[model samples]
Target: MTEVRCPLCKTVPEHGRKWDYGERTTVQCAVCGFYTITGTAVSIAERQNISHKLSAYTRDNTERGVDVPEINSNNLSQLQTSLPDYGVGDKQLLYMRALERRSKFPGSLVQVTPGIDYPLAWASGEEEFLYLLRDLLSRRLVAVPEGGTKALREDVSFETLITPAGWEYLEKHRAVSAISDQVFVAMSFSPNLQAAWEDAIRPAIVESGYKPYRIDDEPHVDRIDSKIIAEIRNSGFLVADVTEQRPGVYFEAGFALGLGLKVFWCVRSDDLEHVHFDTRQYNHIVWETEADLKEKLFYFVTSVAGKRTAT
Candidate 1:
């Protein structure tokens, strides 16, 4: 056992180890008693450095007859692809370019300088220079031998340049960042009031200062495994319609309540009797017409936003 600095905990703490194959691996987190494969860019860089240092440390200890063994390296190449872009500017574009250009040779090596031609391709935009450098240095989770790629292309081009995953990522990034920056009061909402709830109601919810990002307008959001649940949990509030007792929407509303978020429950007048018992604790607002709905919804959202801001 050895004391290690857990990135999440930010302290040198107790750790355990196990032997897998011929390699020795350290426990992830002893205190938390759990393991998580995910990491922030900085954390990955730190762990990579730790892994390298530990390998060397093991070598030195082995020579001293301390019975130290090598740590099996985790493949971080896929994680290198791209997490969500939280930083501002074209960092993501530059990163995607780097990933697409990055090549792996024998011995599970990372080649940064091989046929990439990153520099030449990025020549049109010099601003990306800083973004590229920052990620390269900070997110150096794996060794990228510059000599392997040979150097970045001055004009290596891309096709379409706007992948569906890219667009979905951008939208999610904006929504999540907006919530963080207090740009808009982020709230979960739904307008699905009838058989047409999927159509008419959802957009209206979005238009009411609430982003229905969970319903991902673009069909591409699922591929990247975008953190939709995280976004919903971090929202300013939650609102839902129960006209048809939509199972999915009802679940979302319930989930939000469990998270302790203030909720606004609305339903169509026709199905008022069918409203479930738990949700019926609070009387659901019923709008008779589109004009009535708009006015009521506008006021409800506006009031909720006001209460949130005041607090």
Candidate 2:
């Protein structure tokens, strides 16, 4: 039989499974802990065609298989017979990274610090992220500090450390690693272009599922070059706006390209001729307005850097 694959991680379900209802089909993948429900056809005639349009919306008609609640031990038991076979999905990879950082500390512990560590481990605040944390607790892969309970809730803040079982699991089952989804914006921070960068470019990058960072966004006192290099090194890709023919943007793009990082070259339509001759051969996103820039950049990043998340 053909292996049933997960839509998220592209891993086959260990336990061959399927659940079919007349109007809906719910499928759970044991490999990546992915569960999704899709529309189903009731009869042979109905199965021949099915289409949903915006006009079909009704306040009384509730959506099914869409809400992801905070998953606890009880929830896990209902979903599967056992813990997932491997740590391959986004949450598992993040938890592994947080634990790895904790292991480097004097004591094997990670504090629940927002923006620094927590954001890395958990993907901000959402039911899905809380569910992942709870899943880890249920699996005995991690535990909180002395006074705290093994189960963690969304509101709680405490130090956590990976258990022995977690380490063993990591050694055996970890195959995919998380890539830094930071997209460094390299451009001339001119007063005139501030609105365009902030409103258009930055928001577009964020919508494309990557954190956008610029030198001005940081309040550090470090040397400018050092900060640029460090950010570039940590970033999965760079978006360099070469408008106005800024030397710094070119330098940053060159450094990033030399380091084998993907660079999305962009320019204002009027400034196209001003781009340096050496880099002119590269594909550039030329835009006339902010709306155009936002739309085009989002498409470019999604197409070029979409697979970075799977790494």
**Best model per TM-score:** 2
Against the true structure, candidate 2 has what lDDT? 0.59
Q: How far off is residue 221 in model 1, in Å?
A: 6.1
Per-model C-alpha lDDT, please? 0.42, 0.59
Ten consecutive residues with minimal summed lDDT in candidate 1?
179-188
The global Cα lDDT (0 to 1) of model 1 is 0.42
User: How do the residues 190-234 of candidate 2 rate in per-residue lDDT, one tens digit apiece?
Assistant: 886787798789998988878898989957654577567667755
Clash totals in order: 17, 1
**Candidate 2 — worst ten consecutive residues by lDDT sum?**
51-60
**Regions of candidate 2 where Cα sits further than 4 Å from its true position:** 1-178, 307-311
- Among the numbered candidates, top lDDT falls to 2
**For candidate 1, what is the TM-score?**
0.43
